[model samples]
Target: MIDSHEELGAELAEKVAAAGDLEALKASGAFDELMEQIDAGRLQIDGKDGFLNLMIKAVLERGLQTELSEHLGYEKGDPAARLLPNSRNGSYPKTVASTVGDVGLAIPRDRAGTFTPQLVPRGSRRTGGLDDMIISLYAGGMTIRDIEHHLESTIGTELSRETISKITDDVLEEVMAWQSRPLDPIYPILYLDAIVVKIRDGHQVKNKAAHIAVGVDLDGVKRVLGIWIQASEGAKFWAGVCAELANRGVKDVLIACCDGLTGFPEAIQATWANTTVQTCVVHLVRASMRFVAYGDRKKVAACLRNIYTAPTIEAALTAREEFAAGEWGQKYPAALKTWENAWERFIPFLAFPPALRKVIYTTNAIESLNYQLRKIIKNRGHFPNDQAAVKLLWLAICNIEDKRARERQKTRTTDKESSGNHLVEGAATAGWIQALGVLSITYPERLEPYLS
Candidate 1:
């Protein structure tokens, strides 16, 4: 409420919110300020105002009173209150929508009833809460009727289907704006993958692929760059997706760790010639396992591990030769064949230290994101259109990003390091930093510009 979520003002909310609860807030020397506000004929709090609800309600009521004061050219307790031709007409009951729930507002009045308040004007059903509630439920993949019923059941307030749809449509503008927003010049690493879901296309139901891009910044923090909905996963559509990312200002991508999508590497190179393509080694390993018998899958995986775990590409090739010559490799010939075919792209990460190799060898960033996206839309029957698919996935992305941010905060200097690595401290991203250090040494020229 201080200002629209602004430039570097993300930190503003936390600073403003540091006031704690009413008791602790009052104890923070706000009592004097509260008294001053009361003297101005504004700022009232009831015992029921648990957190900011009282403050929010008081803010609305206080705004109406001030508007009335301005209209009458007098203060509430001043002699002008009586001297004024029109006097205070008390207040009226009205419910204003708020994020927590609905809040009943006492709208201040003038004797002549000439004053029309602006915050919650006459015949207005919408408020902050209604809009927020609609967006929240809609983002959770709720249907319009579902949201309408939920609001009615929870808050005893009913909104029409049209009203619900209209409220949710507000996000389309935001989504478009976000999709077109300028991105950082460089993303150290990007993980690209897709999720397929059914979408209603005219009369028939068709499967559509929603390609998702997750970027890891110069720092280890991950961000989902964009979501693209297409008829299906194909190299042509993926090229267009890469083009869109380039248009959005992603000029340089150091390494793109992705699934073994045929045209994916080519699509990335179309935008960034210098970008190294690291086809996810973990993907190759998993696909290799599928070719092996279930019982011997573990045995094949153990044998194949030597190639990926080798100290250098030469060492990896040597291990590959040994695995290909081994009994397990002979039993599961297809597993070694899969590794051999993708060996060129697979060995790119092996040249670097294990720290960096661990990060770039898998598409875990977007893979994990896709897994969460699938979970959110699992109960959904089918997306109505491409836009609906985009909207739902975007909402799911927002939530997943928030959870990651919280986890980043909760990540202390005392966490365990990695699968095969130990730690200097508990910091969750210690392994990422260690990997970045290796990247700096391996590609000093490419990484120097982004290094602070």
Candidate 2:
């Protein structure tokens, strides 16, 4: 609230005296000195009255560039100076308006520059701090008008709804590139699922599917490999998605667990023949429960638990037989029949060791990923189109993937030192047994290379 030149000078001296480093002192000196000089001449100004005015001017002239460049490691100049001529340039322009007592400044541009400074520049009549305010507003699920008023009341920056939209749209291009990036060659386990988002189609809001693929590398930590959008869950769309992963060098997946989507297994097999598609037993039980009567929900749920919680597949089959004999089963015969038909896919976890079984038995891994997606999408009620939906979903996914990647790298380093030899021996032994079994099957020709 210090407004007068003398008051600003006192604050500056106090700040510089308390500063821990030369750079901080320099930054504070520049900001405070500019404010003091600007405030000194303003008529009828008290310490509190003229502070915001002088501070805004100081921010424009030196504070914006200094802070932004320091943060981004960018020198004070054109943001696009280092880019090639043919490369696409990104522009983000903001309107900054501020007043000091009676003095005011508003900066506007012709909407031409390819670089939009996240930090506002000096002498810029446009409102500064709009970028951060806009992002915060967007994250908070505020409508455009609410954001404008919030900024107006909080920082006195006059931001229009159009300007806010323009600023938020800057994230779209970044989202696109991340969605199409290449993935790893081998994912030990892949978790797949879809989140539904509301999108505007021909003036009507409708639901669209956002498919996400997350992979657990050989080190056992999870990373999001890709995100995609589809009109609906179709074999052709999923096949293309699988093909895209293959083209990105995903040669094999040890286990691909997913909800029971038609043709999903075929789509995966087409991309990597050795990949084992394990249906999510949890999802199956939930789907089955939807058909059960309310009066028998508990009993039916108990019967279903026997299928999943049994010690082994053999035990699970025995439990399944008992469940079929129960009164709940007689009432919900179709539910039990459905499980019987799909029992093979439901029981694959029984063949693997407990460590692997823990991961592949349920779709909770992908379901948790979906939970994160929902958290992000809950703020965005409706997108403009399919592309817009994909873009936002990808941005959220990339943010998650980047964080997961760092943790996974650390986990791999630790695992390598602790259990490297054990992992190799186990993998080799499993490969040998699988190879022998394939040699006795009709696909011996396909198994020859691995056997050799």
Query: lDDT of all predictions, in order shown?
Result: 0.74, 0.62
The residue-by-residue lDDT of candidate 1 on 345-367, one tens digit each, is: 88888877777877888987677
Best by lDDT: 1
Give the per-residue lDDT digits (tens) of candidate 2, residues 401-439: 445544545544433432211111111112333323432
TM for candidate 2 is 0.68
